[model samples]
Target: MAKPKLPIPVTLLTGYLGSGKTTLINHVLSNQEGYKCAVIVNDIGEVNIDAELIQKTGVVTQKDDNLVPLSNGCICCTLKVDLINQIAELVKSGKFDYILIEASGICEPLPIAQSIAVLEGDEEEGTPAICRLDNIVTVVDALRMATEFGCGDNLLKDDVDEEDIESLVIQQIEFCSTIILNKVDMVNEEQLGRVKAMIKTLQPKAKIIEANYGKVSVGDILNTNLYNFEETAGSAGWAQAYDKDEDERNEHHDHDEDEHEHHHHHDEDKHEHHHHHHHDGEDHSNCDHEHGHCCHHHHHGDDDEEYGIGTFVYHSRRPFNQEKLQEFVNNWPKGVVRAKGILWFSDKDKRDYLYVFEQAGVQITATENGKWLAAFPKSEQKKYFKEYPDIEEHWDEKYGDREIKLVFIGQHMDKPNIIERLDNCLDD
Candidate 1:
């Protein structure tokens, strides 16, 4: 028999909106110091992540083929099976030294951590885990901490349900082995201290680090091998409710203390796709409804949204006047917490091109991505459009395959009004 390999480290990279998860990933991938790693992005978008985007950032490793996107739903809840399967695939591939699972801004980390533990135990779950939960690294936005924590009392008072982002953030802080507070440049010394204090209250166990532009030693976040599933099981307030689900799972069976200790994975062990029925008859895969910052996958078994932050996508086939777009970007709505997408700007000579935009809170960043694929010859469109099928459908004869497509996630959004305002900026 071939010599068996050691367990691969699977790190969970999580954070809230604009907390610098991508920045950290890009930083680590670009400066891997000879250590190869693969990334599994849980994209909060319409389709799987575009491979070209990662290439444009120049962060892909030799194991670029390992770029997997679980865009259907949140892996911690609705898409845990996909998470498990992907873990198995990466482990089997054995091309990467480490694997990073970057969760959405609204995900709670404990259950996700707990789910990974299931793979290691001797169980009927598919493909025995060839990897282990190495670390749970949460990238938090230091600038938003004081504000998020200030609404502490009644905001996320959902009684053990991880419905609100506030509860989710607290859970992330509590469960993580490493907490990275990014964007420290935006806050002063006194404010940073207060942010640190707030994090310490919920997560005394995590090793906290402050970073700007997501710059940090890769050694700090990867290969630490610090996760202990037993400690994870008993640590959080949100996990208490899952305990009851565990009790119900074994309520009919007889078992000893040893069995009891290892029986959590047995809850619906054979049923792979776990889901709770919803009144609207939608699976968690389809219930990505807009709330504000509190969006949770509703059809996930035991997961429901009592509070949700609104998320809206602005699409325009008409090209935006560069001056108007710049003005709007300069005065972006304060309520808009995060926004990103490709935009087509008018001005035939200098400005008639496509641009990729990223907005975190009020900060805006844009980069030219050459012309839209539709602008190229029909012979060349196949290769580019084939790489991203979801975006290809938006092509037009006059405008080619270009327009404005951005997703805004935040509170109290006026979708129709926002669309109208954006429409007013269009030259066509």
Candidate 2:
């Protein structure tokens, strides 16, 4: 019997806007090093300038079948289906040994990785399951590292609804297996070291490679076979922090149960005393037992704390006064690295619209996501409740599903002060 054909290895390249993804792609195409790589370029605009630039290099022509351009949306969100279909077509052709995908700067790597993992081929349909993700490579601008992450500049000047660039950049950094720290020549050694330290804190598992003008060893990125869906998904610092928090909570709960049972067997009075102690242990300032809300403060050890790097989640059911909220975000906050979450506003015009707010360094952006479930007809809302039972469990009669849930990550952030300030903005 004939052996099954091996799947083609695919490498996903992602970075923040203006991080030189196109430059790196040009470098790869210019020096194939005996590998036939099919390149898929994705851009946010209608015109794919990246594709055109690659054509100008004369490494690949406009008519080259290996070059595929996807535009108008990001592959991680709106263009997911399109990306899958494109990959399917590319795999069907059997023309290349490897595939290179240039994800849009704002694209999140997790969803794209997830989509590729589940893609199966049907022999009857003439599409074979002949693609395996090799690795995820993220490029970072060494010079802009401090300014872009620290400043409050909006990533996209025209699109208010675009995802916050700073949050997206951090997300891109956290999820990748390899980081190309490009333009090392632009910064001093101290600045470069700081950039490397920040990247290491965000993602310790990813290997960082310093490069100048998007130049790197071609073998370092291609066919590395480092992409493991499960490992990559959980590799982010934020994800690990959440998982650790959950585990600690479970362990505490289990210990309390054991203590209660032992006390009950010995004496009823002792049982009550132990129960009181358990409640005392549970009364942490960062947690709201009554509301079942927890502001998880991730402890990344003493060294990490010295760097002041930490993360916390802010959740509230009340809507915010639009004017006050805007003013608060405009000022932004010092020492706060990144913040992103869904928001609820009390303004009459925006009351029904759910908003998403993002902040990185000094830059922040808020955009109308869509109507809240409460804004829908009662019957329509009931349908959503039926589909997601948990939605109804958390529903407030006055506010329904509208709530504020923001995650803030940074160095030496005053969590209590920030939370109090946000509370002041609430339209109570």
Candidate 3:
């Protein structure tokens, strides 16, 4: 019998933290019609929570009958060795038709793609065949994006740079043939419009798909190659958005920056600033609406250069005052759009802790602890109380204490002032 094929196509699923890469991979693997698929999971940080979640789905195949988990450093960086070994083993197994590799959160997808592309000659004698680049599909958290990047929520950690997150998202888009905008259900009409507009600005060539819980056909995820680095290099959101002449006609420009600034002068006001004025004369007709979310490209010229300031903040330490923080949220800056992080509240009611992803002035939804307090039944609550000696009597009936960990995305936002204000909001 002839050799099956020269090289199999490998699909890459990558995104930043909590952007739903694992969710998408699980969706594809579970819904696969007949394809013999092999999945490789790469996780970051000390926890392999995503890897465990995927394994629980029963979609992950074993390596030499042993489950392969690379959960130390980033897959694109320190874990490349494990990544290669596992993929090679999967290929040699000769049981899979397609291979799906999910990169760790904070990983750069280009290196992962380059690794697969360059490994064509690494297959040993018994290995099925080499692997080739099929497609790089990057998932973006639409709701998180709307609150973090589109709106400019300056609630990120002090040291974290918001620009890095924007640049990272753009880089992921640069290499992807397909871009999955996940969490479409989290935004309102206006917030959705900003999210799509920003995505179109960043990745114009990619075939954008609206996804909820990473639900997209596996076929679309595989066997597609829309990557053209030459074309994508200069034309990505960073450049071409403001240069469209046809769009220039319907666009409106206001010279009054002072007027926009006047609306955001309050120091502790719980609201956001808004400077991108949509004039009535401007025809937003060409915009495409996917599930009521309007998306269109922008012509980036002097206007964008004047307005686009990518900022990110990474803060590991600090506790936030709930009341002051809520007031800050109530008066968030308009230029500052999105922010997602674990929040440590200091209030007697909700001081336990919570995760926050703010978009369009709404803090999406906060989840309760599932591990400790939430797991105990009413009858077992007293018994479980002994397990956690640190639990306060009143705190048990209230909430669980988590932490304030968040990723902030902002555009043209004042980093210094934002950080100062956030620091002030926290306990001394």
* Number of the top lDDT candidate: 2
Comparing 2 and 3 on TM-score, the stronger one: 2
The lDDT of each candidate is 0.60, 0.71, 0.56
> What is the C-alpha local distance difference test score of candidate 3?
0.56
State the weakest 10-residue window (summed lDDT) of model 3: 257-266
Residue ranges of candidate 2 with Cα displaced over 4 Å: 1-5, 77-81, 118-128, 157-163, 252-307, 312-333, 339-407, 419-428
Give the per-residue lDDT of model 1 (tens digit) for 218-261.
Answer: 88878886766655434332232223222332352223111111
- Summarize candidate 3's per-residue lDDT along 193-246 as a digit string, tens digits: 666665654555678898899998777897765543344333443233222321
Per-candidate TM equals: 0.51, 0.66, 0.53
lDDT of model 2 at position 409: 65
lDDT tens digits, residue span 1-428, model 2:
23224587889999987898889989988888977778888888899888788778877654867888899988988998888888878777766777899988778888888777656445777776668888899999998885555444545534536556666778789778999999999998767766776776567667899998889999878988777766666665544443444445444643321111110001121111111100011223265533424465655444555556666666666778988987788766667776766677888888887776766544577878677777888898777778776556556666676767676767677888888788778885
The candidate that wins on TM-score is 2
Pairs with steric clashes in candidate 1: 291-308, 291-309, 291-310, 292-308, 292-309, 292-310, 293-309, 294-309
List the pairs of residues colliding in candidate 2: 150-362, 151-362, 151-363, 152-362, 152-363, 308-411
Question: For candidate 2, what is the lDDT?
Answer: 0.71
* lDDT for residue 338 in candidate 3, whole number 0-100: 46
Better of 2 and 3 by lDDT: 2
